[model samples]
Target: MGSPDPNGRQLDGLGGGISSLSKICVVGPPTRPGVDVEFTFVQVGVKNSDIDYSGNCGNLSSAVGPFAVDSGIFRPLKDSGDVSVRIFNTNTGKVIESTFPVCDGEAVAQGDFAIDGVAGTASKVKLDFMNPGGSKTGGMLPTGNVVDCMDGIRATCVDVGNPSVFVSAEELGIDGTILPDETQNMPRLLERLESIRQKATMMMGMADSPEEVPASIPKICFVSQRNSHMLLSGERLEADSVDVVVRAISVGQPHKALPITTSLSLAVAAKIPGSIVHQHARSGVENKEELVIGHPSGKLVVGAKLDDNGEVERATVYRTARRLMDGIAYWK
Candidate 1:
């Protein structure tokens, strides 16, 4: 990136000035048993030339299966219908099963499905994060508590698809529904979120000191009960349509849209009895079900499967992907 803007504007490179867009994925023939493709996810810095591989991008992970089939790393399971591709994400050491529609022995790429953040419609790819608990750290609840207080902050340190520190935006003197500029431009507010995130990583044993903690993994989210929210783009979110409001900090700024991997953690956190997400999330969430997440971009629905003990069995979400300019571009 070589660009330095607190707003995450990567003027010097290919980054889209956001965390969701500054990414790279390398897929190859699987080396493990029962896996079709193996991948390592790279998160390029939006403001600098640094890259971190400590986590996975759920949005980009959706494209791995189609990439494998199109690249000849895998083949269609049948002549038609749906083909499921097993992926091993090296970053998290977790296996994800991606099911894509098949047509004439090739992965389908066109359909009527659409998602927030990205424009246009494409073929629906169902990504099921198999046993998605504890992508980093160790157990699902790394701190061994659904809710814990640290530095006078009430937060939940859970590890589902990724490790994240979930805190109440109200505790931080905000409602958790503001837009990127409104919150990202405030140094004090951004500091508070980063401080909580560093503390969370330390508390979860992912890092010994705050300085050692990276900004990508162990993501941070400021949440509040559903309310009227005005986006930075001048859009309004009524109360009834959304169960909760979320303002997630990605890399260093407010995420234009919530990260797909973070949504897995959020779904599991919402299912927990006392996590911050559960406190504000709507009730009647059954095991192996879906949780609708409200973010700055729009609403995203995620699937969660919990055991009888309420442990995260799996987390799933639907996404769309297309191969744009597949040929490589040389960079100096």
Candidate 2:
């Protein structure tokens, strides 16, 4: 059991500097079939480091459904069925309804599925983007402009959940397979990327620079195509090599796992006619249900419905999250 603060931030093991561990709760409507499911996020102090609630964890989002089902907060209606959960993130006031397959009247937790940043295999949980482009900025393109030239780089800025500026990795004199440590360790490179992020942030109308109050929006990513196996956890992932690869950063750090919404944005950008991801998308009707992206960790599969007229109906993917513990966490 742990103690949570007024805002749900946890406080435990505060003897040394450590990143805050998060505790989330998935609350489903007690008696309604299609009601909203509230997701409560808590930032637990890592015993020493700063407590952070500045971002929501999509990986934790994976655990919400299972937690709801396991806790009986949301009763299972069938042996194997689809359960939709409308997530109310207390931190951002954003709503995300993620659905997944259930087994034996319970949320499935075992399957032949694996994600880049996560450790082992688990059941496949899919997320559907209803609007596909309106999660963050309330519009497809946050700046209302498709292309924005900043710091001598041409980029496409869009907001699906977190705002991101998409550009090519080749322009930055690197392959798309750069490791997280290597990239983050390079102060000059990081500064340059941060410069782009600041400019893109301003372009997205979020903030002028890093000096200002950091907005929980607008991530910046560089993209390129990869022909080689993606390196993850010291292993290579075997998949179709696409021409467009994306490297995105959140809060000045390479996300261990790509945000679910950002991954959705990648799927849509891959389908659009003029974006950088156009070449990686399926060209014909023969195979149209899958979109796999090569990230620094590995490739992520995204499913979507698209039209020739450039309209994307929905984008989906499978992921896993688990409730590590529950109780209360004190912030202050």
Candidate 3:
């Protein structure tokens, strides 16, 4: 994943030179009952050409319905209006229920809902992930603790949507508003954050060694008090509009936009007592279903239905989906 071009470009590969652009979602017919389809998401490294399937992606998952309808890879469903694609993520072994708007048994691509980072708007996809806790290590709080101190850095190791190590930005001398390029320019900080992630990975029982842990299993992020921040595109955000400003590191860089899975994990962690993300969470989260998480690019609202015992029964979020193309590319 290291060999970028002279201008730090993924010029030699199909990758778009960013962490979010190098992903492959392969859909297959369902092998399990009560499921509409099976999807295996692959993260292709920009320069190394390596693939990691340790977790699922919410962005690519949005396109599954349209892909299934156009390719006829789903099934013989005899329904209309809204169709549910019960996706079994092979990497995390979890079920993602994606409901998309369809017209005449085909996915409709016209809608008014819009998501930041994407150029245009399209039909909205409602994704509800069931039993999302402990996506990797089989427990919500992997260390059985909320906050842990490691190498002078405090972090919360949780695995709701994915195994993530959440650290307060103040602890790392950061404000959680910097963009991805700053992360790529600083090696020592990334190393430290990764060290925390690897330690949490082992504590969560996802790996015996941090160095041996898979590239994409346990993600990392820095949290700070909600503040008026600026996005990479030079758009300014108001502090009152978000609950918390988060800088999530994905594939060793700051995410241009928030990962929906991370938002779900943060929402779940916010409900729990004494987690890092919970410390600065917005008020009224106990009574509210959705939470607004401020990211570097923008903000995303995530909702988690909690049972009486505070367990996340199901998590829901809205995302816009669009088809880039509808053909196969021949590879040599």
Candidate 4:
């Protein structure tokens, strides 16, 4: 193993190939009945020295509940139940609570549930997005419009749990579900999406320019008719294709599994009037509380409760989070 970088170059011994690895942690108390969130994302990649705390990791977000429960950030319940962690994200000034399944008075990790990009099955991790929209730009539609055309792609830019730019699969010459190899083969298509994302970020007011931006939040996704099984990195999701095409971007690439927050954003965008997502979504009434979003891995069920004024009252979903390991990561 390499020695830890004196200038904070290496992060926990993992090669910081991507620009998203620079970070430090200091957990503290929440103003409410949960673990308070206080963490910062630093610049790892020399190319882009900007850290964005506006968005939480949909992947790493799963581990927050377990981290809190086991670390005594919160007292574990006496029975298998929910443990909530109030995330005080530095980037967006937002507090999000991620809930997980606790079994035997300990956080649960074993189950038949599976998420793409991860091997094997684990317990379900659920995240309750408290006012998920506008985590970053202060509005669900950052552009002040539900839908817009960027780089020749019509998209619905909504900030739910995370900022997302939603488009249809057909625009990208896809049916919404393509094999990983097939997608990898289309480097040109991927490159085009990058351009779209860069512009969308500016429209969302996340960056002044795309020159040195790190492709993180305000992810780009495509939607299409749900497939009975969508093959991702060679894995198959056994759910039928939903009405609209759904694809989401994460960390500058197509997320192996759809982001939970982005899923919420998609659900919200699909509801708003004049939004492109609303025009092509599968059979469901507008502002429906429960909407199942079909992803490349499996179908993620999202519930959106709307207020009488037609604004989203609250959006909820079921997910399982487990701690993989807790040890000092050595870097050089």
Candidate 5:
């Protein structure tokens, strides 16, 4: 991916000039036992040269299994039917079990299952994040508290799929349904959120000072109770269809959709009493394992299973991926 381009278009490389589009995944044979493949996720910067490997990408993880099967990194026992791939992410030291359909020794790319953000329907790829707690920091509650006061606002810092800080959008004096373009125009709101995020980063021990914080880790989002809102697609999302509403910031820009890791952390936070997310989420969500989160693009349903100790045992999310291309390029 291109970097250090002031224009930010990344015309010299494969980057799409967006953080989500500027990513790379290196897959290889597993070094550890009981793992089918080991992959490293690289977050390349579009406008800057900062290559961050601080956290895992939930969206990209969905594509690894199919890639493994098609690339022959992990061969399926059956030529046709369902298969599972155990993947170890080097960035987070977590295992993700990817299960999908295969036909004639190739991963199937056509199906009826659909997900938000991406257009059209395709084969469903089920990803079960095993023991996703403490992905980056050392504990689920990295700050040792369910809620911490950051920048004079109450926030819940969680580290399930990734370290995340959640606050109530109502307390921030902003509508929860603000679109990404609208968020870009509010400099002060962005500054305040960055301040809170930096503070949370320090409190979570991800960095010693504000300047040392990586741009990609420690995601921050604001939450609100389920309410009717318009999605980025201009479709109405009813209140009864979702359990909570969230607006997340990624790499200092408003995200078009919720990150999978952030969704995992939010699902975990929703189960914790007294958390800012729990307080703002729809009532009676604690007893339920699945949490439907409404974002700018659409709603995502994530499931979090808690063990006997009430800690997150696993987190589940479904996604769809298809091979865009397969080739090699020269970069200098």
Candidate 6:
């Protein structure tokens, strides 16, 4: 991928000039026992030379299994059926189990499963993050408190799939359903959120100072009670369809859709009493039921299971993936 392009567009390389599109996943043979493959998630800056390996990308995690199979790094036992690939993420030191259909030793690429941001339908990749808590920090509550006061507002800092900060949308004086472009117009709000994020990063022991904070880790998001809203696609999102509303910022930019890692954090936060997310989330959520999260793109259903000791056992989410192309390119 291209970098150091001050113009923001990676015209000389494969980067799409955005944080979500400018990601790289490196997969290979596992170095640990009981794991089929090992991978590293890299977040490359479009206009800078920053190569961040501090956190895992939940969306890209879906493709690592299929890539391993297609690239001959991992082989399935069956010829045409569902196959499971155990992956170890070096960035988060976590294991993600990827299960999907494979036909004749090749991962299936076509199906009817669909996701919010992507168009049409494709094969469903089930990603199960085992023992997901404390992805970056040493504990679920890095601050040693359910809620922390930062920037004169209450926030919940959780470290499930990744370290994340959740604040009330009303406290930010903004609509929870605000679109990405509209958020881009609010410089002051963005600045305030960044300040809180920097403080949270230090509190989570991820960085020593504001300048030392990585661009990707400790994602900050706003939460609100379920309410009818309009999505980026101009379609109506009914309040009853979702349990909570969220707007996330990634790499200092408003995300058009909620990051899968952030979604996992939210699911865990909602279960913690006195947290900002728990306060605003819908009440009477069943223990075994999946959580429906409303975002700028649409809704996503995520499941989080907690053990008897109140520790996160695992988090599950489904996504679709397809290999766009396969080839080699020369870079100057």
Cα lDDT tens digits for candidate 6, 237-276: 9999998999999998899998999999999888887889
TM-scores of all predicted structures: 0.94, 0.77, 0.93, 0.80, 0.98, 0.98
Q: Let me know the TM-score candidate 2 reaches against the reference structure.
A: 0.77
Better of 4 and 6 by lDDT: 6
Give the per-residue Cα lDDT of candidate 4 at 299: 61
Model 2, residue 159: what's the lDDT?
65
lDDT on C-alpha atoms for all candidate structures: 0.83, 0.61, 0.80, 0.65, 0.93, 0.92
Clashes of 1: 0
Q: Report, for all candidates in order, the number of backbone clashes.
A: 0, 18, 0, 27, 0, 0
Ranking by lDDT: 5, 6, 1, 3, 4, 2
Tens digits of per-residue lDDT for model 4 on 11-129? Answer: 43554533334433345556544446554433233234444454655445556667767777667546667666667655555555677677766788888877545578887777666
> Residue 226 CA error for candidate 3 (Å)?
1.2
Global CA lDDT computed for model 4:
0.65
Residues 199-290, candidate 3: write the lDDT tens digits. 87887888887667877767798988778878877999888998877888888777888777888888888887778888877766656778
- The better candidate by TM-score, 4 or 6, is 6
Report how far off residue 256 is in candidate 3 (Å): 0.7
- For TM-score, candidate 2 versus 5, the one ahead is 5
- Report the C-alpha displacement of residue 301, candidate 5, in angstroms: 0.5
TM-score of decoy 4: 0.80
lDDT, residue 132, candidate 5: 97
After superposing all C-alphas onto the true structure, candidate 4 shows an RMSD in angstroms of: 4.3
